[model samples]
Target: MRETPVLVRPGDADALAAGRHGDPFAVLGPHPVADGAVVRCFQPQAASVELLDGDQAVAMTRVHPDGLFAVRLAAEPARYRLRVTGRDGAVVESEDPYRFPPLLGSLDVHLLVEGTHHRLYQVLGAHPRAFDGVTGVGFAVWAPNAERVSVVGDFNGWDGRRHPMRLRHEAGVWELFIPGLDHGTIYKYEILARGGVMLPLKADPCGVWAERPPKTASLVWGQPPRPWDDGEWMRGRQRRADRHAPVSIYEVHLGSWRRRPDEGNRPLSYLELADELGDYVSEMGFTHVELLPVHEHPFGGSWGYQPVGLFAPTSRYGNPDEFRAFVERLHQRGIGVIIDWVAAHFPSDPHGLHWFDGTHLYEHQDPRLGVHRDWNTLIYNFGRTEVLNYLVANALYWLEEFHVDGLRVDAVASMLYLDYSREPGDWLPNRFGGNENLEAIDFLRQMNQLVYQEHPGAMTVAEESTAWPMVSRPVHLGGLGFGYKWNMGWMHDTLDYFSKDPIHRRYHHNQLTFAQLYAYHENFVLPLSHDEVVHGKGSLLGRMPGDEWQRFANLRAYYGFMWTQPGKKLLFMGGEFGQSSEWNVDASLDWHLTQYPVHQGVQRLVADLNRIYRTEPALHQFDTDQRGFAWIDCNDRDNSVLTWIRRAIDPHDFVVVAGNFTPIAREGYRVGVPEPGFYREILNTDSEWYGGSNVHNNGGVEAEDVAWHGHAWSILLRLPPLAVSVFKRDG
Candidate 1:
């Protein structure tokens, strides 16, 4: 350990002025001194240094003429305060900043052995020395400002009087070498100031164990090994044939997915959720299950955004091993699991890790750049090296440690700008004064690079609303490198069109067509996220126009269009069953709504849609290839009808989709097709299973020939208003 004496220059008036307030050493030197060590403090501004014992002051001869005070305590356990008077007789106490009541010094230490040769010290109430028969204890703390530190916890019985901690000089750390006392001991720190003010240290930011007030330290226990058997199950399924194939997703909040009021409304456990939801997802036909944030969070209602412990799975949802088992179960059932990860901001809980070391340790201290006004949370200084590591490590932790297949990064738009949700003067501009937060951009790039390099098959999706160019592009090409992005445009446009009157829809028909024009430019996923079903906007089923029957018809037509559209899809919880009420995070999903015909019909339609998508080669095929899709007829504005054909590169495989936006059925309408062979009706939105008027064309109806180019054919068929139909050409 390197130890140097404090320096005082005669001409440095500022350094001297700083010293008069206390032991100039407190301001300029390390604290929590050890016995048999010579320590010195120099105040260039101090007129004199007088040593005091319990308010009785006595002048001490200066060891150096240059305002340097040196003293060597005769034994261990000594407490001394300094009296430094300024040139004007101004006196300051060593405990000026630390006015709180001094804690009793009874230090206790618990030695925990994490692994062979890996020992940890967990300090409990003040005591002294290592007790017999104890094996090990783990020790950690959050202190960014202390010059010297040491562990003095319950193992020592709060006694700094005996067994004082020695500072680990090189690491800016303080440690107590305990020989015995083992795990499950409470602890606190004995931090020596450069001056005389001594304080207790705080908890570790990355602590696995946490406890509430009155119960100081959490009991750290070893995690039991979990047995999972999904590796072989995942490798057996065929890879997705097409990217655009009716990729429907069921978004869920596990805690609220199922609960009964009679059962005290307790949330389902991880094992129960997997058992119940796995079957439900398979039956619903959704290709993936996108879950709300599942990481350990301090507040339940904040929706898991304000994470305190990034590594630990929320103890609220079973144990760490149980969560692993739950994820493995999902994989075994052939459903991909997507978890929400929030690296944007964190809660400012004192015990949680905001400023554990009494400095802006984990976050930026400058309020202009560090504070998130809208959330009242602490924003990470993404520019810092350690901060970047923390976030990147967290992402890897979820994917490798918990076996999560994908990550849907929440609030990415907020992470992209310096003025995100803030006004002028309320936020600080970067070096360029531009709105772009370059630090955030650099951090995002690094995070994406690390994730892709470490886990190639793992998917990273961004919830970015802004038109940030190349967000889904690979990092080598200057893109953010997300696998996919939530298609906010589609959600907004569809919601806007659905809420409008039929007469008004004529003007807004372009909103539905506009998404297709540039949809393939960036890999996109159409999402009806939780935002659409919360805060009075109502559920997706409730957003339809017209009367009760017409409303259900509108919903059915919308789903048909959504499935046929050239992109992946995600539906928030309660949407597949046509939930009538808005989502309530506090309660279970509206499972009771399944009894209603409209709701059941919606569910049946979704299930059939998934089945058709799996059977058809045209839907998901060409998900990124431009040549796989074409609009057969988009100019039928007067009839409120749109026709599109999805084809595979092989030319023999294809599916034709037609949508009629009007509210009245049109008989014997002739629509164009891509191939001239017999076109058979595959899926109709107006089927009785979907709560339609039973006007669907019978399956396997052959289409007659017509004069058209490029193997195109025209078919005259009965087209229902506000419905969609898919046809496959029989070879």
Candidate 2:
């Protein structure tokens, strides 16, 4: 018969009696171990534990009848493995599971000792004062299945023999506490399995510091308090102005935005970029600046998606301190900054947080839930409690550390589905056998909740292309709780309509007009993001179907329609000036194109769009509120004409916008107006400032009342083709 395992409490006897059999794992002691202290693996499932010196296996004594085996060696440490055998006298498992160097398949095991696991790193604990001047170094891993684990890093010369970690059990967790080693010590783990298997060393899954060469864990130095001068800015945090308010966003990729002056044309430092780009964006009248991923990534050109160090800002840009300064500067300039955050998947780089602590920690252990076959990346197992903490902590870290105003989550569609881009038999369904990845959905909801709860003024945007409803709905309504979603339908419809030849565009006009039917369901942003120009899709200018002049004309018309549409506007770099060549991150934007009138016109149009958006209150008032916009005309598709009215909540003040898509100018066209009075032209696409013919109607025109339709009073005006006109009759 098996003997009951002895349980001991560090403090109270009554507490120990109540918790004795309830908790399966318990720490033997809070052993005060040195950096290179020697320890051993203990497991109940195995017959015995043997310490293997090279090819020789030294047998360990069984200390407990419950299958606890251990060994202690005093000799200088070197490469070693642990071997386990079953009761049948057969080799049950071997340590260092990988057959080759780098130890790819090694699982990270935690040694439960004291109140903590031997391999667990602590940041803030109950004994905070113990770490006051102590500069405590914390480590974390994502292994959920390992029976035993230990850490061995540069502080121990990557030797698993000399310094093995002890795992302390706490609330179903295994941890270890090392007192001596402070900051800047590289480490990896040695794990022993209950099945008698030896695995190679692995890094921490949530490690902030990592290196590729010599195979070592990251060394994190304690950070000092961030230097911020925007105390007033912090106090002013509030919900942003309504959606219809003039909103123009400039999307930028930091690395390629501008090159470094000193490092052979490398990217600019965060400080340098803040000084230059901040002023440029602010001067351009963009309310917000959306930056690509700023998270630490091993791959530069991947657009910051394969995040390994979620808490660490990418060292490639600058130090975390410098990045904070950059954000503070943007805040000082009264411009909101939004970062592209990728929470979908991470790269499988060994030095990263993939298998740190010798187990599948961050990702799912099973192939079904943990793998991202489409991107060759590791999918995060959001169902685990530790994993939830890891991700939630990351999101909060950015908001608290960087003081960012918003985040545009990348690839949300991928996170919303279990069988996304997966073939039959290749993917696993949830318990309900549904294609929806409920775990991912729960994680997204939790992340959004935490973000909003902690940062009230912050915004969360989703780059989801699928028709997932309630993406922009409130959290209480069973939604993913994003502030806004990219209007992908508008992007596709507008691109498809504009890519056609002028003669062919007449047939495709409905593509542009039809998007309004469902536009009110959620707050949306019209985006011409980096995806449109990369990978041989060609530049926006190249998408035009006509010769030089007509191409320019078509492009201008496209911009006109985009500006008049009811949504926030975001444009990628080089797009505002009609870049002829497709964007490549390796090269700079085509600044020399300013010499051409067409390019200058595009720039002017962008500027005017910003001005128009800002000056017209009607455009922004309807952002979240439903009653701000109304379509006055939707039927005139044959002549390529559409009309809409943006009215203030007061109903007395309003603006009427009309656009004609024909190639030639039209005269004496009777267009319906909301009010009969002097309807002055506020903006015209055919103006010379926007690279068009100088055929604009002067400042104000009086509209005479005539019996046209059932309404007795109507306005007759000359409407220019491929042009946008906004009129206002304010009493």
Residue 319 in model 2: lDDT:
67
TM-score of 2: 0.78
Clash numbers, per candidate: 67, 46
lDDT of 1 at 530: 90
lDDT of 1 by residue, 1-731 (tens): 13223222333323333222212223322233544534344433358766555665646435445555544433321444567776688885341111111121222111111111111122311223322322344343424355444444564455433223333233323343343444445554544444445543444444444443333333343444566687764453224212434446788888898986898998888888888988899887877788888766667777777877666566665766777888888788887777888888888865455654546767789877788888899888888654665567678777776777778898899889888988788787889878888988887887788777776656788999988888888889989888788989888998888777777777887888888777876788888889899889998778888888888888888889887777787888888778878889889988888898878988899888888876676877765566778887777777778888887657879888889888888887777775667778888878887888877666645555774423346877778778999888887
lDDT of 2 at 181: 59
Q: TM-score per candidate, in order?
A: 0.77, 0.78
CA deviation > 4 Å runs, candidate 1: 1-137, 147-204, 209-221, 233-247, 708-711
lDDT, residue 512, model 2:
81
lDDT, candidate 1, at 159: 44
lDDT of model number 2: 0.67
**Whole-model Cα lDDT of every candidate shown, in order:** 0.67, 0.67
Q: Please write out the lDDT profile of model 2 over residues 530-578, one tens digit for every residue.
A: 9999999999999988677667777877887787677888899888889
